[model samples]
Target: MGMMKRLTAALAVATVLGGGLVAANAQEVVLRSADTHPDGYPTVEAVKFMSDVLKKETDGRISIQVFDSHQLGEEKETIEQTKFGVIDLNRVNFAPMNGIVPATIVPCMPYIFTSKENMRSVMDGPIGEDILKAFEPAGYVGLAVYDSGARSFYNSKHPIKTLEDLKGLKFRVIQSDLFVDMVNALGANATPMAYGEVYSGLQTGLIDGAENNWPSYESSKHFEVAKYYSLDQHSQCPEVLMMSKVSWDKLSPEDQTAVRDAAKQSVTKMRELWDAQEEKSRKIVEAAGVEINEVDPAPFVKAMDPIYEKYADTPELKDLVKRIRDTQK
Candidate 1:
């Protein structure tokens, strides 16, 4: 009888342990992550960082499945899907988000940030927080910002060494009034088009030039078609990683903490990657026969001053710009 009682106790303990293991396994959550960049880009690296950290920190309770090269869809479609709760997360350029949250356009205005450090200070500080807050009403929870280096001009026709050089050139631009106005102020015909079509458009001579960072110009091989890369560095539009409000609301407080912590880590890592990648990209483009010109930015800055004036009527935007200019150190 004593032997039988001991066997029964051991069986009960084993059953409880097995049940606990099963319960823990059942708590797993799978998330979907989407971005427009191709697999080998630095943007994809940042997404992977978030995925790896989240899985490890959650002890495998959560995992992110990443979609690169716009496998899910374009920026607009991805954002719409996120808003409708069909997707969990997406990394978007601020230009597209401006459509959903108009206030986001404020940051993309020409010359809003005079230097990379100034831009970093604004985005990593309270001003960026305020911009993030503007997205909540549109069903997004902004997590972190990824650097999309400063925007500059590239053309097949001529090197834009001065504002006059840009005159009458057809320049491709994103569908943002801020971009349009800035390009217009420089005397170029701003042609708004989707990014995927830029290479072909430039190749076929449908457009004379476009503006983007060094990495994008190199990676997309736009340097092959457009020979001149003028470093105007007119605007610094950082991409944002955002979560679906529907998905975020479902997370327990502990899981929310894990996600936020992972996002912060990814942002810091991305900045380091961006700085390194920008240098690498410049070398690559130069090797590919792209002539890089470092023009005096003062003329460009002076030409874009009207953009600031256009927004000056609004106290919030004016004050925000003042604060950013003051915060430079």
Candidate 2:
């Protein structure tokens, strides 16, 4: 009878050990993330933060690998790959995705945001949530929004101090209807082009000017050719961190929670990096012999009023603009 009891006890111990081994094997997960920006940019910093947190939180069971500097592909291409489940995550500008998700274009409208603080408030609240929800149909899960900074004009021709100064200038703009329309309304010819082509376009004088935030302007060395830096702050364009719905839905509940938590933390870090870089960018461009001018934005604001009115008439987009304006402080 004692011999029989020993056999039973050994069987129970083996069962427990097997179950523990199965649980350990189930915890491992790997995810991939992509971005178009070069290393050392704010977006990369944020992605790195996410990668570090996910690994630490899951005790090495979850890991994220980031592809930077367009190593995977351009923003739009990367986002499309994410949708098709080829890539797990990407940081993309809202412009290209606007076609798939219409409301994404609203924030790119000129003069929509009065200040950086106002932009942050609206994006962190209901308006931001609504925009994020619009991504579901496109097979993307919008995780967080990172600052792209306020876009302004840069040209090699001449300084754009007044509305008339922009007349007939061929300015390269991203492929967005709102951006194209806004540039047209200001009396400049808007030539839609890819971000990678802008530097060479300016160098060859194929395009007389382009518009972007200070960090981009300085980092891409557009200031080298475009000696005129006009701080019109026309649009506050924020970059979005998104994940493939396929990959997101595949995560265990615990892993999903961890990913969300890491995303939130990364956004806070990205904003701090962006703010510091914007200030540093301004000094760098000024020292590079790039003429930095703070012009009156009233003219640009007045020019885009009609664009706002048109969007306001649309049922879905109307309330968001009102909410943003009301929340402005």
Candidate 3:
């Protein structure tokens, strides 16, 4: 009878508290995320950190399950899955996001950012926020951007000491028109190929060279066959973390805040991991006897003038590029 009386009293107190009523149990939410990179990649690590932070901030009410290495699907497939609400979150390259959110092209444009510091400054500021916000109309919410490092030219045949050396060399490039055009503008024959086939392509002498960041070159073991690495640092293609609008809308207001805050915190964690990974990869590649070279980027910059003229896709895009170029770190 005393227990019954206490239960009744507690019910009466809860009714009086109205919307402020406390419940003994809360709903649990599980979010599914996907990353194309392998485990231990900086982007994968960032997602893992985000998962931990979300669980902590939401008091275990929310948990994220991350699928890496195309376990769910390739980047483009996973993007569509996120949009359809099948995947709650995604880690993908920003270049493809331009197809859904055209404003992202500003960041994907070749040689736009003067350096990584310059790029991060723009990305971590209002401009980056604006770009992320642009995803809303496409049924996506951008959570954060991550480092992909600037891509540089590397090859097995010869060293690219000057602009002339780039001519007549067949190079493998990402299957993007911008990258293809950039390679052609640089006086090389651009052969579009899938990333997985690059090693065989280099090994079999199908292609003479490729362009990518240090971590990719080293991690992919492209440096083993391709001994010459020229640090032209041509493009700074960033990675993006995104959530489906459908999934986001399902989150409670408080949970929404928690997710956004967790994403913000994860960005800081990724920057550190990415920088350290790049340095470590560079050291490993150099110690492996990769002949690294630094070339004057002026000629390479001039080579892309035509590409810029062609890529100024809109007044908005042109203005965004101008803002990025004018931004000083």
Best by TM-score: 3
The TM-scores of all predictions, comma-separated, are 0.85, 0.85, 0.89
Ranking by TM-score: 3, 2, 1
Estimate the lDDT of model 3: 0.84
Q: Enumerate residue pairs that collide in model 1.
A: none
| Window of ten residues with lowest summed lDDT in model 2 | 14-23
For each candidate, the alpha-carbon lDDT, in order, equals 0.81, 0.81, 0.84
Best by lDDT: 3
TM-score of 3: 0.89
For model 3, how does the per-residue alpha-carbon lDDT over 150-224 read when each residue is reduced to its tens digit?
999999988898899999999999999999999999999999999999999999999999999988898899998
Report the C-alpha lDDT of model 2 over 1-329, residue by residue, as the tens digit. Answer: 24334334433542564411122366676676778787888899898988889889988887777778877666656665677566778898877776788778778778889889888888888889889878878898888888889999999999999999999899999887778888999999999999999999999999999999888899899999999988899999777888888778877788889987898789889998989999898899889899888889888889888878865457777776777778864
* Ranking according to lDDT, highest score first: 3, 2, 1
Residue 310 in candidate 1, Cα distance off native in Å: 3.9
- In each prediction, how many residue pairs overlap at the backbone (N, C-alpha, C within less than 3 A)? 0, 0, 0
Q: Candidate 2: lDDT over CA atoms?
A: 0.81
